[model samples]
Structures are given as structure tokens and as C-alpha cells.
Target: MTEPKTRRTRNGARLPADQTTPRYLGENIEKDLREVSERTGGGTMQSRILVAAIALFAERGYENLNMRTLAGWVGLKAPTLYNYYASKEQLLVEAIELGMTDFFSYILDGIEDVPREDRLFEIVRRHAGYKMRHRLIARANDRLIDPQFARMFLPEDTARHFSGRMADYRHTVEELVRDYVADDALVSPKVATIALLSQCDRMAYWYDPGGSMTPEQALEQVTILIRRMLGIAA
Candidate 1:
């Protein structure tokens, strides 16, 4: 029997000729893959590559997604793909960070202008809307930051950065919950914030754009549920 030749990139990175079986990132991979397959028509080459990378990572898991596979998705040679992202780790980090930043900004933008009484609802609406619109990205971001995966796959500094960002967002939500809770409400704001966010975030896993419920109806129902949970009157 002849030994199969191992392929190497210009920088001596090994390229796997065959796709490796996908590893489990978490329970969300199956749902993420479904959403990834439904997406199409990203704007520019670099943007399209990023979009494709997210989809591939969701479909193939971190170890199974190779440069050659990603490059093929973007219609570029493997070495040429390196010009955009030097390594799989670099690409994964960038994709995760970009998605987090965008998700945060989308939920926070114009929040300062919202009336005090309406601010919580506004933030909840945006959060739910973004998840419905970008479910695959949301799922990928969530999985990549899982403590087990983060500690094992991401550099310590990168993991810390994501943790800090997540903490900041949580604190922001806590403050909002504190302000919105009724004067005599018995709930702790921090606990309520966690519960509220968990409810909103889970939408990414189950929300169906094509289902009987429209995004508008879904957001309205979510906001109503949030209000009742917070003891706010309808």
C-alpha cells in the first residue's frame, strides 16, 4: 500500500485532502447548519467569504473546516484565501468578534434616544429581531463562546475579551431591568436580567421566519411576555 501524500500550504500549513467528520460544538449545530444552508447572496468577496466561513464552521465544526474547503466556497485558491485570513483560528476569531460586535451594536443603537419607559421594550425588540434575521450567526457566536470550546480553542486573551464584552452587555441589561421593575416587585434585577436575556436569546434556536407567526407578531408576543415577566402592566 502506498502512503497518501500530505498537502502543504506555502507557509507549510497542512491541508487535509478529505473533509473530516464534524465534531460536536454543542446541541445547536444541527439547527445552525439548517439556517446556514438557507442563506445566500452576501455583498462583496471578503464579506461573502466571511459569510461562507460562518456557514462552513457551523456545518463542519472548527477542526473539520479546512482552508481548501473555505476557499472553494468563496471561489478562490487556498493560498489566495490565506491573503484574507492567515489561519483557521484567525478566521474563526474574526468571525466571532465581528458577529458579537454587530449583534451588540444592532441591539444598542439608538437606545439612548428611546424614552425611559420604552427603552427595555426597544432593546428586547431589537434583540429578538436580530436573532430572527441572523439566526445562524447568532448560533455560531453562542457556540464559539461556550466555555469548553473557548478555553480549548481560543487564546486566553481572546476568551477574556469575549467574556468582558458579554459581561458588559449583561450589566447593561441588569440596569435596564432594575429601572423597569415595578417599585414593589420582589424580583432581583440581576436575576431577572439573566432570565429575560435567556428567553430572548433562545429565539435564535427556534424562531421560524417562514412559520405562521411573522417577525412582527413574534416580537410583539415576546415583548408582552417580557412585560408580564417583569410585572409591567400591558
Candidate 2:
């Protein structure tokens, strides 16, 4: 059998040979922290801490992060950090909620005004754009679906709320797929919805802002691929 071909980003990070497979998360912590700091500049101190916490949790794993380390990243003493977030778990929950809130708001904003036929494409475009622009929070959002993390780390109410929000998002996509493919007998909305989201979401693992494609170009290319996948005519 011929070996599958892999490609490297401009930064020389190798991606999976098969585009359908999600790539493993790997990033330079120092670089990510610097970017996070720059992005959160002028935000409230609490907001800065939350952003730092998300970046740290995403890159270092929730179990691997501690209050002291998180505080140090945000220039706070451990006890002072507790004034903002009672515990690391609280911080995690808040971070997840904040990230999801921003994601949903960004993607859904003005979607209602879009022509019905173009709504799915708009959503996909926004999703791809957000993933590229907010790499750290996107990675942190990915952790919400990890079986181990949900089962072991999340509080019951928080887990239930997150799961419900995710399900609602999936259902929204499925509805869009159903409407988009209403005339096609062969496409299953449920399956197509999963495929479409999987394609866009996986970009978080391999996309590099410094890569050959600018964010605008990348979003266009991704929406084009998704349109082709869904058999939408240009």
C-alpha cells in the first residue's frame, strides 16, 4: 500500500496525512501565552485571568494545572486568585461557559438576516474564522467533550448545562442541513451535520495563523470544501 502523504504548516508543524482524522493538539506554551496576553490586553484583570486559565488548561491539561501556576501566569498570588475564582474547577467551568458564549454569539450574530439558502455557509465560515482567531479558547472548548474530563472533573450541574448547550448547537446544524438538503433524497441531515462540523472543528488542531493561508483565505477555502461536500452548487 502507498503511504499517505502529510503536509507541514509554515511553522513546520506536521499535520495528519488524512484530513478527515482530527490532529492531536500540540503547541508552544510560551508563544501561546504571549499571544493570549496580547489578545487580552486592556481587558479587565478578571478577564485576563480567565483567558490565561483557558490557555493554560488547554495546553497543559486541567489535571496538570494548579492554582499557583495559573495565578503566576496572571500575576496574582494564590489567595488573591481565589478571590476571583474560588477554585480551579470554578475557573474551568467559567472559562468553558465564557468561550461557548462568545462562540455562539459570534457565529449566530446576524445569521437570521442571512438568506436561508446561505445560512449554513455563513455559520461554517464564522466557525472556521473563530477557530483560527481564538486558537487557545477553541482548544479549551474541545476539552468540554472529553469523556474523561466530563466524567471526572466537571460538576454535575455544570456538565449537564454544557452538554445541553452542545446538543442545542448540534441540533441547530442538523436543522440547517435538513433545510439545505431538503430536495436531495440521499443526504442524511444528521450524518451530514456531523461531517460538516467535524471538518471545520478539526482545523483548530492543525491551523497556523502564520501559515500560507490568511484567515480570510482559509475560511473561504473551508466553506468551499464544505459546500462541495454538501453538493451545493456555486
Q: Write the per-residue lDDT of candidate 1 for residues 167-191, one digit (tens) a residue.
A: 9999988888988775356877877
lDDT of 2 by residue, 1-234 (tens): 665686554567554342212122444444444444454443567766776677667655676665776776667778999898877888888877766776788788788999988888889988877777767567776876565788788888888888899889999888888876664558677888889998888778678888898888878788888888887865
Model 1 reaches what TM-score against the true structure? 0.78
Instruction: Name the lDDT of candidate 2.
Output: 0.72
Q: What would the TM-scores of all predictions be?
A: 0.78, 0.78
The regions of model 1 sitting more than 4 angstroms off are 1-42, 182-185
Minimum summed lDDT over a 10-residue window in model 2 is located at 15-24
